[model samples]
Target: MAAFVLRTHDYRTISRCLESYGLAVERSAATWPQRRFTDAAERRRAVATVTALGEDPAGTESAGYFHTRLHLAR
Candidate 1:
Protein backbone atom coordinates (compact mmCIF):
# COMPACT_ATOMS: atom_id res chain seq x y z
CA MET A 1 0.00 0.00 0.00
CA ALA A 2 1.03 3.55 -0.63
CA ALA A 3 -0.09 6.85 0.81
CA PHE A 4 -0.41 10.24 -0.82
CA VAL A 5 -1.93 13.64 -0.25
CA LEU A 6 -4.50 15.02 -2.63
CA ARG A 7 -5.31 18.70 -2.52
CA THR A 8 -8.76 19.57 -3.69
CA HIS A 9 -11.73 21.83 -3.10
CA ASP A 10 -14.30 19.11 -3.69
CA TYR A 11 -13.27 16.39 -1.28
CA ARG A 12 -16.65 14.70 -1.05
CA THR A 13 -16.86 13.97 -4.76
CA ILE A 14 -13.28 12.86 -4.89
CA SER A 15 -13.75 10.61 -1.86
CA ARG A 16 -16.69 8.95 -3.52
CA CYS A 17 -14.66 8.29 -6.62
CA LEU A 18 -11.85 6.85 -4.59
CA GLU A 19 -14.29 4.57 -2.78
CA SER A 20 -15.51 3.27 -6.12
CA TYR A 21 -11.93 2.37 -6.92
CA GLY A 22 -11.71 0.36 -3.69
CA LEU A 23 -9.31 2.80 -2.12
CA ALA A 24 -9.60 3.89 1.48
CA VAL A 25 -9.88 7.59 2.15
CA GLU A 26 -9.56 9.30 5.46
CA ARG A 27 -8.95 12.74 6.91
CA SER A 28 -5.39 12.79 8.12
CA ALA A 29 -4.20 14.32 11.37
CA ALA A 30 -0.75 14.85 9.98
CA THR A 31 0.98 18.10 10.72
CA TRP A 32 1.70 20.46 7.88
CA PRO A 33 1.62 24.17 7.30
CA GLN A 34 -1.68 25.02 5.67
CA ARG A 35 -2.90 28.56 5.04
CA ARG A 36 -6.62 28.84 5.40
CA PHE A 37 -9.50 31.24 5.89
CA THR A 38 -12.47 30.00 7.88
CA ASP A 39 -15.22 31.58 5.83
CA ALA A 40 -15.97 33.89 2.93
CA ALA A 41 -15.89 36.86 5.23
CA GLU A 42 -12.51 35.90 6.57
CA ARG A 43 -11.18 35.40 3.07
CA ARG A 44 -12.47 38.79 2.05
CA ARG A 45 -10.90 40.31 5.12
CA ALA A 46 -7.58 38.80 4.17
CA VAL A 47 -7.91 40.23 0.69
CA ALA A 48 -8.67 43.61 2.13
CA THR A 49 -5.68 43.44 4.43
CA VAL A 50 -3.37 42.52 1.62
CA THR A 51 -4.83 45.28 -0.53
CA ALA A 52 -4.29 47.75 2.26
CA LEU A 53 -0.68 46.71 2.23
CA GLY A 54 -0.68 47.66 -1.49
CA GLU A 55 -0.61 44.04 -2.63
CA ASP A 56 -2.99 42.53 -5.08
CA PRO A 57 -5.23 39.85 -3.61
CA ALA A 58 -5.53 38.25 -7.04
CA GLY A 59 -1.77 37.84 -7.12
CA THR A 60 -1.75 36.30 -3.68
CA GLU A 61 -2.86 32.75 -3.11
CA SER A 62 -6.48 32.32 -2.14
CA ALA A 63 -7.30 29.71 0.43
CA GLY A 64 -9.84 26.98 -0.02
CA TYR A 65 -7.13 24.73 1.19
CA PHE A 66 -8.12 21.13 1.73
CA HIS A 67 -6.15 17.96 1.70
CA THR A 68 -6.91 14.29 2.18
CA ARG A 69 -4.82 11.19 2.44
CA LEU A 70 -5.42 8.11 0.33
CA HIS A 71 -4.20 4.60 1.04
CA LEU A 72 -4.05 2.49 -2.03
CA ALA A 73 -4.10 -1.27 -1.54
CA ARG A 74 -2.82 -3.48 -4.25
Candidate 2:
Protein backbone atom coordinates (compact mmCIF):
# COMPACT_ATOMS: atom_id res chain seq x y z
CA MET A 1 0.00 0.00 0.00
CA ALA A 2 1.31 3.38 -1.01
CA ALA A 3 0.08 6.63 0.50
CA PHE A 4 0.59 10.02 -1.05
CA VAL A 5 -0.37 13.40 0.34
CA LEU A 6 -2.45 15.15 -2.26
CA ARG A 7 -2.26 18.92 -2.67
CA THR A 8 -6.01 19.13 -3.20
CA HIS A 9 -8.87 17.11 -1.77
CA ASP A 10 -11.40 17.56 -4.57
CA TYR A 11 -12.68 14.31 -6.09
CA ARG A 12 -12.21 15.66 -9.59
CA THR A 13 -8.64 16.58 -8.80
CA ILE A 14 -7.95 13.10 -7.51
CA SER A 15 -9.54 11.53 -10.55
CA ARG A 16 -7.41 13.65 -12.82
CA CYS A 17 -4.25 12.63 -11.02
CA LEU A 18 -5.20 8.97 -11.23
CA GLU A 19 -5.83 9.31 -14.95
CA SER A 20 -2.51 11.03 -15.49
CA TYR A 21 -0.80 8.22 -13.63
CA GLY A 22 -2.66 5.58 -15.70
CA LEU A 23 -4.29 4.19 -12.59
CA ALA A 24 -7.90 3.10 -12.26
CA VAL A 25 -9.72 4.17 -9.12
CA GLU A 26 -12.66 2.44 -7.53
CA ARG A 27 -14.51 4.70 -5.11
CA SER A 28 -16.61 3.41 -2.26
CA ALA A 29 -20.02 4.80 -1.46
CA ALA A 30 -20.43 7.10 1.48
CA THR A 31 -22.17 5.88 4.59
CA TRP A 32 -25.76 7.00 4.53
CA PRO A 33 -28.72 7.75 6.76
CA GLN A 34 -26.83 10.52 8.50
CA ARG A 35 -29.11 12.10 11.08
CA ARG A 36 -28.47 15.21 13.10
CA PHE A 37 -28.56 14.18 16.70
CA THR A 38 -29.46 16.39 19.62
CA ASP A 39 -27.73 14.09 22.07
CA ALA A 40 -23.97 13.94 22.36
CA ALA A 41 -24.04 10.19 22.93
CA GLU A 42 -25.87 9.59 19.66
CA ARG A 43 -23.39 11.71 17.76
CA ARG A 44 -20.52 9.82 19.27
CA ARG A 45 -22.04 6.54 18.19
CA ALA A 46 -22.50 7.76 14.65
CA VAL A 47 -18.94 9.05 14.53
CA ALA A 48 -17.72 5.65 15.66
CA THR A 49 -19.51 3.97 12.78
CA VAL A 50 -17.95 6.35 10.27
CA THR A 51 -14.52 5.84 11.81
CA ALA A 52 -14.90 2.07 11.47
CA LEU A 53 -15.44 2.54 7.74
CA GLY A 54 -12.20 4.59 7.50
CA GLU A 55 -14.11 7.80 6.89
CA ASP A 56 -13.88 11.11 8.64
CA PRO A 57 -16.79 12.09 10.84
CA ALA A 58 -19.29 14.38 9.19
CA GLY A 59 -18.95 16.81 12.06
CA THR A 60 -15.28 17.35 11.45
CA GLU A 61 -14.31 20.95 10.70
CA SER A 62 -11.61 20.29 8.12
CA ALA A 63 -11.80 19.16 4.55
CA GLY A 64 -9.47 18.27 1.63
CA TYR A 65 -8.46 14.91 3.01
CA PHE A 66 -7.90 12.08 0.51
CA HIS A 67 -6.84 8.50 0.97
CA THR A 68 -6.54 5.96 -1.80
CA ARG A 69 -4.92 2.66 -2.75
CA LEU A 70 -3.55 1.65 -6.13
CA HIS A 71 -3.38 -1.83 -7.58
CA LEU A 72 -0.35 -3.08 -9.45
CA ALA A 73 -0.22 -5.52 -12.35
CA ARG A 74 1.77 -8.68 -11.89
Candidate 3:
Protein backbone atom coordinates (compact mmCIF):
# COMPACT_ATOMS: atom_id res chain seq x y z
CA MET A 1 0.00 0.00 0.00
CA ALA A 2 1.20 3.54 -0.77
CA ALA A 3 0.12 7.13 -1.31
CA PHE A 4 0.19 9.56 -4.24
CA VAL A 5 -0.49 13.20 -5.05
CA LEU A 6 -1.95 14.52 -8.30
CA ARG A 7 -2.45 18.06 -9.48
CA THR A 8 -5.71 19.34 -10.91
CA HIS A 9 -3.94 20.72 -13.93
CA ASP A 10 -2.85 17.22 -14.90
CA TYR A 11 -6.23 15.63 -14.20
CA ARG A 12 -6.24 14.10 -17.68
CA THR A 13 -3.02 12.29 -16.92
CA ILE A 14 -4.38 11.18 -13.62
CA SER A 15 -7.58 9.93 -15.24
CA ARG A 16 -5.55 7.96 -17.74
CA CYS A 17 -3.42 6.56 -14.98
CA LEU A 18 -6.48 5.47 -13.04
CA GLU A 19 -7.90 3.78 -16.11
CA SER A 20 -4.64 2.00 -16.82
CA TYR A 21 -4.52 0.80 -13.21
CA GLY A 22 -8.06 -0.58 -13.45
CA LEU A 23 -9.40 1.73 -10.81
CA ALA A 24 -12.71 3.53 -10.98
CA VAL A 25 -13.39 7.06 -9.93
CA GLU A 26 -14.94 6.78 -6.49
CA ARG A 27 -15.74 10.39 -5.77
CA SER A 28 -15.02 13.89 -6.99
CA ALA A 29 -15.63 17.49 -5.99
CA ALA A 30 -17.17 19.92 -8.39
CA THR A 31 -17.21 23.24 -6.55
CA TRP A 32 -14.68 22.61 -3.80
CA PRO A 33 -12.34 20.43 -5.89
CA GLN A 34 -11.54 16.89 -4.77
CA ARG A 35 -11.07 13.31 -6.02
CA ARG A 36 -10.86 9.91 -4.42
CA PHE A 37 -10.02 6.32 -5.36
CA THR A 38 -10.47 3.06 -3.43
CA ASP A 39 -9.18 0.40 -5.78
CA ALA A 40 -5.72 -0.93 -5.00
CA ALA A 41 -4.71 -0.97 -8.62
CA GLU A 42 -5.92 2.60 -8.91
CA ARG A 43 -3.68 3.55 -6.05
CA ARG A 44 -0.72 1.99 -7.78
CA ARG A 45 -1.85 3.59 -11.00
CA ALA A 46 -1.95 6.90 -9.19
CA VAL A 47 1.70 6.50 -8.36
CA ALA A 48 2.53 6.04 -11.98
CA THR A 49 0.17 8.86 -12.94
CA VAL A 50 1.83 11.28 -10.57
CA THR A 51 5.22 10.10 -11.70
CA ALA A 52 4.30 10.68 -15.32
CA LEU A 53 3.00 14.10 -14.38
CA GLY A 54 6.59 14.92 -13.32
CA GLU A 55 5.66 15.84 -9.74
CA ASP A 56 7.33 14.15 -6.80
CA PRO A 57 4.94 12.00 -4.80
CA ALA A 58 6.35 13.57 -1.65
CA GLY A 59 6.20 17.06 -3.10
CA THR A 60 3.54 19.56 -4.25
CA GLU A 61 2.77 20.96 -7.68
CA SER A 62 1.78 24.37 -9.02
CA ALA A 63 -1.75 23.64 -10.27
CA GLY A 64 -3.23 20.42 -8.87
CA TYR A 65 -2.48 17.83 -6.22
CA PHE A 66 -3.45 14.25 -5.31
CA HIS A 67 -2.95 12.05 -2.28
CA THR A 68 -3.55 8.33 -1.83
CA ARG A 69 -3.41 6.18 1.27
CA LEU A 70 -3.48 2.47 2.06
CA HIS A 71 -7.13 1.43 2.04
CA LEU A 72 -7.58 -0.35 5.35
CA ALA A 73 -11.05 -1.75 4.91
CA ARG A 74 -12.86 -2.37 8.13
Candidate 4:
Protein backbone atom coordinates (compact mmCIF):
# COMPACT_ATOMS: atom_id res chain seq x y z
CA MET A 1 0.00 0.00 0.00
CA ALA A 2 1.06 3.55 -0.68
CA ALA A 3 -0.23 6.92 0.35
CA PHE A 4 0.04 10.04 -1.74
CA VAL A 5 -0.02 13.57 -0.39
CA LEU A 6 -1.54 16.62 -1.98
CA ARG A 7 -2.36 20.15 -0.97
CA THR A 8 -5.37 20.60 1.31
CA HIS A 9 -6.92 23.15 -0.96
CA ASP A 10 -6.97 20.66 -3.83
CA TYR A 11 -8.54 17.86 -1.79
CA ARG A 12 -11.50 20.10 -1.01
CA THR A 13 -12.68 19.94 -4.60
CA ILE A 14 -12.02 16.26 -5.31
CA SER A 15 -14.79 14.49 -7.18
CA ARG A 16 -16.96 11.84 -5.51
CA CYS A 17 -16.09 9.26 -8.16
CA LEU A 18 -12.46 9.43 -7.14
CA GLU A 19 -13.38 9.02 -3.49
CA SER A 20 -14.40 5.43 -4.10
CA TYR A 21 -10.80 4.39 -4.47
CA GLY A 22 -9.58 6.01 -1.25
CA LEU A 23 -10.90 9.14 0.33
CA ALA A 24 -9.92 10.02 3.83
CA VAL A 25 -10.05 13.68 4.56
CA GLU A 26 -7.66 14.96 7.18
CA ARG A 27 -8.92 17.00 10.09
CA SER A 28 -7.36 20.42 10.23
CA ALA A 29 -6.91 20.12 14.00
CA ALA A 30 -5.34 16.68 13.98
CA THR A 31 -2.02 16.47 15.84
CA TRP A 32 -0.72 13.55 13.80
CA PRO A 33 -1.65 12.95 10.17
CA GLN A 34 -1.97 9.44 8.76
CA ARG A 35 -2.64 7.87 5.35
CA ARG A 36 -4.01 4.56 4.04
CA PHE A 37 -3.76 2.77 0.74
CA THR A 38 -4.64 -0.60 -0.72
CA ASP A 39 -1.56 -1.27 -2.84
CA ALA A 40 0.66 0.06 -5.56
CA ALA A 41 -1.56 -1.01 -8.45
CA GLU A 42 -4.64 0.16 -6.61
CA ARG A 43 -3.15 3.57 -6.04
CA ARG A 44 -2.11 3.73 -9.65
CA ARG A 45 -5.62 2.94 -10.71
CA ALA A 46 -6.94 5.50 -8.27
CA VAL A 47 -4.85 8.17 -9.88
CA ALA A 48 -5.84 7.11 -13.37
CA THR A 49 -9.45 6.70 -12.36
CA VAL A 50 -9.57 10.16 -10.85
CA THR A 51 -8.29 11.65 -14.05
CA ALA A 52 -10.94 9.74 -15.92
CA LEU A 53 -13.52 11.13 -13.53
CA GLY A 54 -12.35 14.58 -14.51
CA GLU A 55 -10.85 15.36 -11.13
CA ASP A 56 -8.03 17.83 -11.20
CA PRO A 57 -4.64 16.39 -10.32
CA ALA A 58 -4.15 19.20 -7.83
CA GLY A 59 -7.18 18.05 -5.82
CA THR A 60 -6.53 14.30 -5.72
CA GLU A 61 -5.01 13.99 -2.27
CA SER A 62 -7.20 12.71 0.53
CA ALA A 63 -4.69 12.79 3.38
CA GLY A 64 -2.81 15.45 5.32
CA TYR A 65 0.85 15.90 6.07
CA PHE A 66 2.62 13.42 8.32
CA HIS A 67 5.14 14.73 10.82
CA THR A 68 8.64 13.70 9.78
CA ARG A 69 11.98 15.03 10.84
CA LEU A 70 14.37 14.96 7.91
CA HIS A 71 16.83 17.12 9.75
CA LEU A 72 17.52 16.85 13.48
CA ALA A 73 19.32 19.72 15.13
CA ARG A 74 21.78 18.76 17.79
Best by TM-score: 1
TM-scores, one per candidate: 0.35, 0.32, 0.34, 0.31
Off by over 4 Å in 1: 1-34, 59-74
**Clashing residue pair totals per candidate (backbone < 3 A):** 0, 0, 6, 1
Q: lDDT, candidate 2, residue 42?
A: 52
TM-score of 4: 0.31
Model 4, range 1-74, lDDT digits (tens) per residue? 22233322233344343455575433232122334445766556555554565543332323322221111111
lDDT of 3 by residue, 1-74 (tens): 22232342355555556667776543332222245545656556655666676645444221233453222111
Off by over 4 Å in 4: 1-35, 59-74
Candidate 1 lDDT for residue 11: 50
Compare candidates 3 and 4 on TM-score and give the better one: 3
Instruction: Give Cα-based local distance difference scores for all models.
Output: 0.50, 0.42, 0.43, 0.36
Please estimate how well model 3 matches the true structure, expressed as its whole-model Cα lDDT. Answer: 0.43
- Work out candidate 3's RMSD over C-alphas: 12.5
Give the Å shift of residue 32 in candidate 1: 12
TM-score, ranked from best to worst: 1, 3, 2, 4
Top candidate, metric lDDT:
1
**Least lDDT summed over 10 consecutive residues: which range in candidate 2?**
61-70
Give the per-residue lDDT digits (tens) of candidate 1, residues 8-53.
2325665677788987776554423246667887677656654564
Worst 10 residues of 1 by lDDT: 59-68
